[model samples]
Target: MKRIAVLGSGTAGLHLSYALVNSGAFQVTVYTDRTPEEVKRGRVSSTQVHFGPARAREAAYGMPLWEAGPELESIHVTVGGQKLFTGGLVHPAKSVDQRAYFFRCMKDLEAKGVSFVYGRVDEERLQELARAYDLIVDCSGKRGPIAPFPQIGELSPVTTPQRKCSAGYFHGVVPLEPAGVSITILPGAGELFEIPALTALGPVTILFIESVPGGPLDVFGGIKDPESFRDRMRAVVDRHFPAVAARVDGEHFGLCDERGFVQIAVQPAVHRPYCTVGGTLVLGCGDSVVLNDPITGQGCNTASYCAEQLVRTLTEEPVGPWDERTGEAYWKRIRDYVTEVTQWSNAMMGPLPDHAVGRLMAAAADPAAADRIAGWFADPATAYEDLFRSAAGTKEQAERQGGL
Candidate 1:
């Protein structure tokens, strides 16, 4: 049997390792920096809502089921203080704290007989891994690909971070009706996403702020203490997002734990997912290859999607040396979907186009339109089409006018 080495244990690495081991076609080993216990006890890593399609992929790979978090049925939208429509999802989504999710999955995968080597994989170790395994899949997440995968310049257009992200899981916040994710957009200032989530401390609401740099909502810098973070978040809500503030039970409101919050900013970039390291063909998956801003909440979903595609590409190819051709084939299968997701995600970080704004206004008057908008989070292809379709039409119209 062929041997494969998977790097990192985040959504991408764990998912790919599970699928590979289940297939019984390859001997798979995972290298990660953190152990399961450490992950569970660590600070919150990200705010995740695994929508319908991503959850389905996990289920197919026999990943562990999470029954704790609220079943997100709809997406409640509010723009500039006006309550918009609630868009229902075709399939329910759930947000479990990555601290809980990743830790559990790592332990579960270990129990399933996947070898786990715990340590940071540096350049020297990576070269050693290249010589040992037949294939090395880099699922190393935001911090790296570790291998030298060339960045695709055209796709990596955004060189700077678009939003200052501050997120925390807290108690005493009321959940919205219909049990869903709540999105509050403050136009130029940024957005607030209130998500009902399950953590090791039980159910909590994740208040995520995507603030434009130096904007009113970009207030979470330098406060390292949990109490300070919690107080600042509360103040920001009361001052800016009154809708969400109204649901805050101030007497009991505070972070679920001292380590339940994180502040981060992502500079979006995309890289060609294949390369050669020490004469061995290496591949990249997840954020290591397709990083994007969290404004659209597509990171985990994108990682899951790419992991499944990589598995399909590997299994379909004839048994032989996995080379540049294999990487090209894998990239070909996922490029279109990745483009759609990346474009939509990047667009979200900027001002909403006129057509997109119109769609939101129309959704307030039409439930069907609202539902379609909600589905965009689950499937970004639809969002991409909606945003670009108008632009394409406008270009054609200009061409016609010029000819006339």
Candidate 2:
């Protein structure tokens, strides 16, 4: 059996480790920064809402035994505080608190007898691991492309951060009128996403604010205390989103737990996902290679999808060389998909094109158009061309395409 070293235990690493562990085709060892217990007690990392494909991958891997969270049936979009549209999805999406999800995933992997090393793997350790293992897969997330793979300039089209993100899991907010994802775009300001999610504490709401730096939405950058964060979030809602504010019970509005809130500034980037270390080729999977802005909620789903693709590529050809050529082939398999998602996500961070705005208006008036737009989140690959290109005649096209 080939020896594989998977670094980091985020969505990509855990999924890849689980798949390989069950395959019995390789001896997989996962090195992570923390153990399951540690992850459970740590602060929130991200607001990971896994769409249809991500959830399917988890179910396929036998890790879907999560406490039920809110069923995301549709997407409600508002621009500049005006209602754009509310559209239903063909397949539902779900969000689990990362602290709970990551912790449980580690324990699951451990129960399956997968080897896990706990600690950070710096350059020296990574070089040593590369020499020892037949394959070294980096799933270190936003912290790296550990093998020094050069950034893919064309693919990484952003230099400055478009949003300073503040996200928290809270109770006391009234459920959405539509009972789905409530995404409000403030145009020159940032965007706010109110989602119903399953966390360790059961069903809670996640309010993710993407503040455009130096813009009106940039308020939570200095928050450190939990109470201060919640109060400030409430104030932002009251000022910008009166409808959502009306739903928030001011007396009870706060984080779901002490560690259930996170604030970060994310600058989107992409990199060449493969590189040579100590004469052995190491491959990058997920965010280690293609980290896009989360404006469109593609981060976790894309990572899960890419990991599964890598698993298929690596295992399907058992007798192949695990060298630079193999690494390059693995990159090729996921390149287009990653690039498409990145471009589409980046496009969403800026001003929506006139045509796109018109489509939003049309969606507000037409249910078929609204459903088509909502389907973009469920299976992005299928809707990429139509969703991003032109909004011309979308109502007719949506009717013909059967509303994604």
Q: Best TM-score goes to which candidate?
A: 1
TM-score of each: 0.97, 0.94
Off by over 4 Å in 2: 387-404
User: Candidate 2 has which clashing residue pairs, if any?
Assistant: none
Q: How big is the positional error of residue 229 in model 2, measured in Å on the Cα after superposition?
A: 0.5
Candidate lDDT scores, in order, read: 0.92, 0.84
Model 2: lDDT equals 0.84
How far is 216's C-alpha from truth in model 2 (Å)?
0.9
RMSD of 1: 1.3
Per-residue lDDT tens digits of candidate 2, residues 1-404?
A: 88999998998998888778767788989998898899989998888778888888888888746567778888999888798888998878888888888888888888888889999999999989977998899999987877798898887888988889899999998888567899998888888999998877777889999988999889887789898998899899999988799898877788988888988877788987788898877888888888888888888888888888888878875566687777777888888788778877887888887777777899888999999889888777646666554444665697889966
lDDT of 2 at 395: 56
